[model samples]
Target: MISVLFFVLLGAMLGAALGYASQVFKVESNPLVEQIEALMPGGQCGQCGEAGCRQAAEAMVRGALSPAGCPLGGANLTQQVAELLGVSVTIADADIQWVATIDESLCSGCGRCYKACPFDAIVGATKQMHTVIRDVCTGCKLCTQVCPQQCLTTVALPPDSRSWFWPKPQTAAA
Candidate 1:
């Protein structure tokens, strides 16, 4: 009973020390970086020349990158990010929206496209018809390159009423 009591006390003491240390060494994230990241598209496509949106946000906060760095987010997101960062920015043309389409007749159900898709937008089983989840697809084109049957193709998505947004204003030549 005495040994059990001693062990309990020792455990409690260590727990208390750990809790105190955690409180004393708490790390706070920069709100600016969080805001910038929130404004990003979260595509993780590396189109911004960074590994991911969080890294891009950190770079933007550190003045090593610009708000226009993300092509996937386009001019609208750049404008929003620029406003949040208190910086003037020129908007670039929005990227063409693309969606993958799998020709069922040509699809061998090899599952290559499914395995290559980073977003899991392609859904099918081996020896079955694979279909592209258009809504979930980021149109990264990873599926097209990996399809052994060459059945996958990417096409520009026509904007519907719900998908349409105001076009960016064109600037005059300096």
Candidate 2:
């Protein structure tokens, strides 16, 4: 009975100590990282050399990366990130937006492009002409590189009503 009582006391003491430690040493996520990530395009594209936008945000907060690290986000996003991080940085030149177009005449329907696309943008059956869902394509060019017939080509996406956005309001010249 005494041994049982001692064990119960020891367990309770350890539990209390752990609970106190957890409260005292609670780790908090950096708000800067969250802000940086929120400003990003959330493309999950690795053009920034990071795994995803969240990772890039973390790197930027940790000073391991620059605000212009995201190629997909472009100048506007860089500017936003810079402002959030309280750093002055030159806006990166925007990259041309490309959309995958499959030439039905050249497509062999081997399904290579379908499998290569990370976004599931390509739709078709084996031995049938494959079509690219333009709306879903991120234009990472992963499909173009994997097409054995070179049927997949990236075309510059023209701005449509959906792509258009109002320009940011400029501040008064000092």
lDDT of 2 by residue, 63-110 (tens): 899887876665567778888888998532344567899999988899
lDDT of 1: 0.83
Best model per TM-score = 1
Please write out the lDDT profile of model 1 over residues 67-112, one tens digit for every residue. 8787656556777888988999754344467889999999989999
Report clash pairs, candidate 2.
Answer: none
Regions of candidate 2 where Cα sits further than 4 Å from its true position: 1-27, 38-43, 92-94, 160-174
Residue-level error in angstroms, candidate 2, position 90: 4.0
TM-scores, all models, native as reference: 0.76, 0.65
Candidate 1 error regions (>4 Å) = 1-8, 161-163, 168-174
lDDT of 2: 0.81
